[model samples]
Target: MAVKEFKLPDVGEGVAEGELVSWLVAPGDRVEEDQPVAEVETDKALVEVPSSYDGTVEELFVEEGEMVPVGDVIISFRVDEEGEADETGEADAVDEAGDETAAAAESEAAADEASAEPGTADAEPEPAAADAEPETPSGRTFAPPSARRLARELGVDLAAVDGSGPGGRVTEADVRAHAAGDAGGADAGGAESDEAPAPTPTDVGSGDRKSAVRKRGEDGSGDAPEPAGRDTTLATPATRKLARDRGVDVDDVPTDETRDGEAFVTGEHVRAYADALESAAATASTGGGSAEPTPEPEPVDVGADAEPAASDAAGDAEPAPAGATEAGGDETSAPESGDETVPYRGVRRTIGKQMERSKFTAPHVTHHDTAEVDALVAAREELKPTAAERGVKLTYMPFVMKAIVAGLKEHPYLNSELREDEEEIVLKKEYNLGIAVATDAGLMVPVVDDVDEKGLFELAEEVRDLAARARDRSLKPAEMKGGTFTVTNFGAVGGEFATPIINYPETAILGLGAIEERPVVRERDGTSEVVPAPTLPLSLSIDHRVVDGAVAAEFANTVMEHLETPLLLLNE
Candidate 1:
């Protein structure tokens, strides 16, 4: 039989290495070609790695919970061969290696036998010395040295974790699982003895994600018993610092992660538990012995189940949340008990980097104006019936989009991007308008191409479909790419006149604020009259490095003019 190596393949863009979350096959297991043998997690998404050849698994080169780079051999398979006639130098070397392996095995067997002999208490010093290694439990826990070091740093007990690696050996992921308190630790009696076999591909199920360990007690105020001779809380170093800074006891923090029927804590759990406690205290102080029980804090949906949007372009900075700590925010104080630190990962991380780059790279200047959208609103309402007849729900965004495109045609600089490296400004002829939709995860901008070519009905239908898909996170990466400009209707979320950072490489972004009826002065027969008008708030942010204030103001005026008289859109 010839042993063949299987290497990890490139999954997608920007993924150089991936963490091996779990192994599906083990030694001696027969695998089919294209059969999934492991689950890997990259920054983009979680994916399964399939085997390249059908054969009996000989060994797994890498353990689970470790990061493996692309093209690294991860598993080996013993393949059936018809003939083997070669007895060359390579074969002799392999034979010698095999002989050495057998000799070592014999030595180990002899030591085991010597140690087990009756009345041989001090006969096997070498075996005794080998057994004295820290984190090396007797029965199993066959983790690599890297895993042991990590366990020591995290204060995790290696013996407690259920290994998911080959031969039931503990892996890096197992140590991480132990630290997070969701390793499904062995029963107290089974921890130090008995080999815990790794679950096979058929036995293991999908969706086995690690969860945050929960705090102790229902209300989180009861005293929790500590684990014997060990730290009860299982938290990262940052979480411990957060707890100490907030003057909260780490032991009081609860988590959803539990093992051996004991709750383990994480940074998120600590923040949540402390927030609940503060809210309870505030209610008590306000009630002042009224005998009404304090109400529980309403749970915040963390968007755990939200689908991810399309990946951002390379070098695009991740976006940050509004009012997030800027570069000069206070650095000394511990985070408040009620303040939760949301890690910048996935979409949020991309947004933060993107926003920071845009804010710093482009000299942004924003101008605020209002447009009387009474005509546009009436036009949409008039067309609503026709749109509904075709099974489409139309909104004001389509009218605004058409108006913006008309305005862009009248003044083309807003539809252009400045190529600083090339020392030239390229004005895009095609109108690929990006529509920003707020999703459960974050803000996603899905582009609608050739907007200028499509009619109002087409624009309305396409816009409606794109927005729905964006919120559901079903948008493809291509649908979010090649935008000439972006439009953010913050008005839909009850905001007005935000100085939106430009979606970098693009010259400008137009923000539409809440449209409401307000008093306006109008000229009637050369006399001023005060009347209520439906006005839409507009904030235009432009790259000052390319477009001047005069150009920006005129562009804003033209957009408002089209918005007020939307029927003029047909003139184009």
Candidate 2:
């Protein structure tokens, strides 16, 4: 058979090597062209490598988990050929000529046996039988010896049992089945149940020792078992030391709650557990060293009028209430109320890297503006019933996106990129608006491609799909990239104003703050009366190198005007 070697190819971006995660096929398996042969992982992402040619696998040169460089031979395939190897001294003499020739001979021999029929190959030569004792190359006893003994004892038919043992030698089970007269009905189920019993708890410990003994006997080496009671929970070396110092059980802390299946424990969870323990200890000490303290009486349910009077009295107090802390403390420490540290991986890691790159690369300049969305709010209220009938829950984001698209159309410079080399600025023709979605996996900005073409309803649908995919990590790299501008909604979290960092290379990002009911002067017949209008605070950060103060201000003004007159966005 003709053999062809397949080498690893360079995937992309000048990657030198990749870890072979798994092989989809094995030796002797026939593979088709372009079929996935193996999965590989690089530093950036995981990718599947497909087979180059259609052929039967003759050899596997590299094992899974091996780091293979580009252009390195990984696998070899065999195609049906005309001639067999010459069974003469010529081939042997040529093979013994060099060390590489010896390796090739061994590989060829292995490949031959791997694709060989039964009772073939010199490497696995016949063993010695009891009668005529034909000695095997490994100097081991053959299965025929055991089969003869078993056949005589069980009174089985020698010809009835199919010989699958080495060199077509019959095994003891085969002889037993032959003698049973019902060889076809030998009860394969019963035979399986007669297998070695499951190791007991004591046997498990002994099995470990036995395994060590076998290993030592085989290779004369091993590592010792870890200390008893040491938690197996994954934590950083520094965090483990902190846990030990604080006398905390790392296993009891639930840092993985925020991370789903990720096996990582955080320092914050350790600290919180320690705090809880300290609090419990102090409470116990205060209660005359008792482990259990007296329970406080449940509050009596007051009538509605009485409850209002009590709340009014409490609201009138000058000093801050018990357990209440200053707002500044919330930023540094855990929200005195409740806080959590999500593992910095997955989408969170992506967000962190993108933000870090954006902030460092782009010279951000933020311009703040407020929009009186009184008419927009009125229009939304009017459309609410119709929107409900259409089975779509209308939100401010769609309106804001529509308005932002309108603004971008007016000032196209804002919807462009700054060149990395600081040579030239390329204004993009397409407007791909990326909405920063805050999910369980932190912030993920998924782009809405060609936003200017999509209607408000269509944009809402795309936004929903993007948000869902972003949360599930099913978004493609292209979906997250090539955004001309970004929008982060801090309004969901009740923030009034925030200067969002430009999502780098892109010229600017817009932050939508909480829409609140604020008093506004409404012009009525040349006079004005105070009225509660829905007002939104917006913060726009642009790359100072590309967009100047005037351009940013004009963009902000245009966006504000669109939001002020909601129908203008619909018309545009």
Q: Model 1 segments beyond 4 Å from truth? A: 1-339
Question: In order, what lDDT does every prediction score?
Answer: 0.62, 0.58
Encode model 1's per-residue lDDT on 1-572: one tens digit a residue: 44566788987666676767688865556789999999876544457788888776655655565556777566766555555332111222233223334532453432333222122224343233224322112333455544644454343555567889867777788888776774333332334213222222211111111122222222223222221222476554545655554335666554445434565454455444444444333434455342334332222223322221212343221111111122321222223445565544445556677789999999999999999889988988898999999987888887888888887887798999999899999999999999988876577788999988888888888888988877765565557778999999999879767999899889989999998998899999999999998999999999998888889899889989988988788864
Per lDDT, the best of the predicted structures is 1
Q: Report how far residue 296 has shifted in candidate 2, in Å.
A: 53
lDDT at position 335, candidate 1? 39
- Residue 37 displacement (Å), model 1: 9.5
> Which candidate achieves the best TM-score against the true structure?
1
> Over the stretch 319-367, how does candidate 2's per-residue lDDT look in tens digits?
1111112221111223323565333443445567878998888888899
lDDT of 1: 0.62
